[model samples]
Target: MAPGVGGAITGAAAGKFFSWLLESERARPPRVFVSFDFDNDQQLKHLLIGQTKRQNLPFSVVDGSLKEAAPEPRWKEAALKEIRRCDVVVVLVGRYTYKAPGVLAEIAMARSEGKPVVQLIGSRSLGYTRVKGAGKVLAWTQDNLTKLFGND
Candidate 1:
């Protein structure tokens, strides 16, 4: 092997190694999309939002009420787009949430996209209809969420 050529190869390797090292160190976390029945309860939305912020998870809450205008049915398409882009989908189900059309649509879309869907049945028992097709159902509490997703 040529001595000078060896130095060039080694220098190139070191430069590439350092670049990857820095990139990994500063990498952004994956996003999670939170879906819940907007008509269900204010307290649930507030708690979920607070938990997301506290954990520093990149996320967007899909609440139609927060927007300035009424949501079109196509908004489901937009919302699912966000869900597909995210690494995880968190479905919070209260009594009202389970019965809400929007929440049902969101859950089905998320499942269709093959995203990891975690169903949180909070403080409420779901009727057989609501529980029938759920792939994974977990406790609706914050602690259970931490368990499923891993605490940050």
Candidate 2:
């Protein structure tokens, strides 16, 4: 093959590959609502979100972090709005999760909105206390996440 023709073929192949990547990203699963105790589970939340992004996972977080400056009602409303937009909710159940009213309320909102709930136990020894409408209580693992939201 002529050198110019070979170069043209390679360029076209690269373009097609990148186009497919973009389309795959756009076709990923709906945003996920993450419910957790902001004070206690923030690190775990960040770790999970970071890992998903680092590995190019097929899910995006709905940013349920409440502004501490906002009033309680405002925070609740904001969280509910996010939950309504999400396809599924993942409750990060840390040791203090049961004591967090906001986390519990977020889970309730997800349930009321008919969003599927997955309770991710942050600590293996903590023992899972099933969230009201959670369909599964899974340990925090990339494989589990992939199982719930298949790789795109």
- Residues 18-131, candidate 2, lDDT per residue (tens digit)? 999988866877688888878877877888888887996777787778646478889988888888888888888888787688888887788788888888988867654665
Provide the global lDDT of candidate 1 against the true structure.
0.66
**Model 1: residues with Cα > 4 Å off, grouped in runs:** 1-28, 54-71, 125-131
Q: Give the alpha carbon lDDT tens digit for every residue of 1-152 in model 1.
A: 88799999999999999999978744645456777666655566678778777774443444433343246666776787787777677776676665777666777887898887777766554442243344578766656655665524
User: In model 2, how large is the Cα lDDT of residue 143?
Assistant: 88
C-alpha local distance difference test of each model: 0.66, 0.81
Clashes of each: 0, 0
- Cα RMSD (angstroms) for every candidate in the order listed: 5.3, 8.8
**Of the candidates shown, which would achieve the greatest lDDT relative to the real structure?**
2
What lDDT, from 0 to 1, does candidate 2 have? Answer: 0.81
Give the Cα error of residue 142 in candidate 2, in Å. 0.9
Top TM-score hit: 2
How well does each candidate superpose onto the true structure, as a TM-score?
0.63, 0.74
The clash number for model 1 is 0
